[model samples]
Target: MKWSIVFLLISVQVFSQKIIWSDQQKLEWSNFKSKVKTMRNPDVVAYTHCGWEYSSTVSSDPSVPVKIKITTIFREDKSWKDPKRINDYALLHEQKHFDIAEIYARKLRKEVMEHIKTSSDYNKNFKIIYNRILNEYKDFQIAYDRDTQNGMNKEKQAQYNASIAEALETTK
Candidate 1:
């Protein structure tokens, strides 16, 4: 009986963590897709679900090109109700991802050449920098998560600011 109860509880929690993007998330993601269309000239899509925060590109067909997937956290909180703020957050963070992807699109050939010539440490450092960039973006996500729990709007905005600062510093 105890084991069954625990299983049910876990299942409830897992089901609760679902993607339910607000209209604001959709609008922001739509704008993001428009911008990326010009920048990447490829297919783009954004998905938001509770308890998950990430994005990627995938190729479903051999002849078809890769498509973008901007997955973000979908919290059941008041922050998402505020279209302006959440839109701002989504735009900023997803743009960073898009910008990084665009950089890779342009430099993949060069990076591959450099990766072949450089020491393992160089490749490791490159990965570290890439991770730093991602972390810089996630700083906003952390703030959003915290805000959703505490209703700290200012703190959430500050997270975006900090993320931008950290991203700039990492690039340098």
Candidate 2:
């Protein structure tokens, strides 16, 4: 869980159909054409299944120090839209959800690096750190929807977008 990754998308391997997040790669309305869950509430407008994937390896050194890497993925197939609410503004809101995931990933990366560099036991602390950050990420995602009223508040949505972008840069 103590990752010391160099930079963004260092390895371009196709882990799956997941589209790794990027500023250049904005999600289009066409990307929202996937079918929605039938059992879900009809009132819901859209869903963005943004998530993170992590991998770890211990160094060859005797200590077997752990190295963890976390990457966020926007699960396009799992995500869906109501079709009626599909618009630039709605898509922007969805994009912010993905961007928010990146913010947490960056924060997680920074924490793991600092922990590995300073702590005596990296492996033991990895899970604690990972779980803590993961919890925070989930909370923030919910708070985002609540505060912005599911992207109805353009002002709040813009603020969240700015905060996410700034968090990403500072963590880098």
TM-score on alpha carbons, each prediction: 0.25, 0.80
Q: Please write out the lDDT profile of model 1 over residues 10-121, one tens digit for every residue.
A: 8975665333333233334433212111212122123222332333333343333332233334433212222333445544544443333323322332333343233443
lDDT of 2 by residue, 11-39 (tens): 44343446788878987656654585632
For model 2, the superposed segments whose C-alpha errors exceed 4 Å read 1-15, 38-43, 59-62, 117-120
RMSD of each: 16.2, 6.3
> Which pairs of residues have clashing backbones in candidate 2?
none
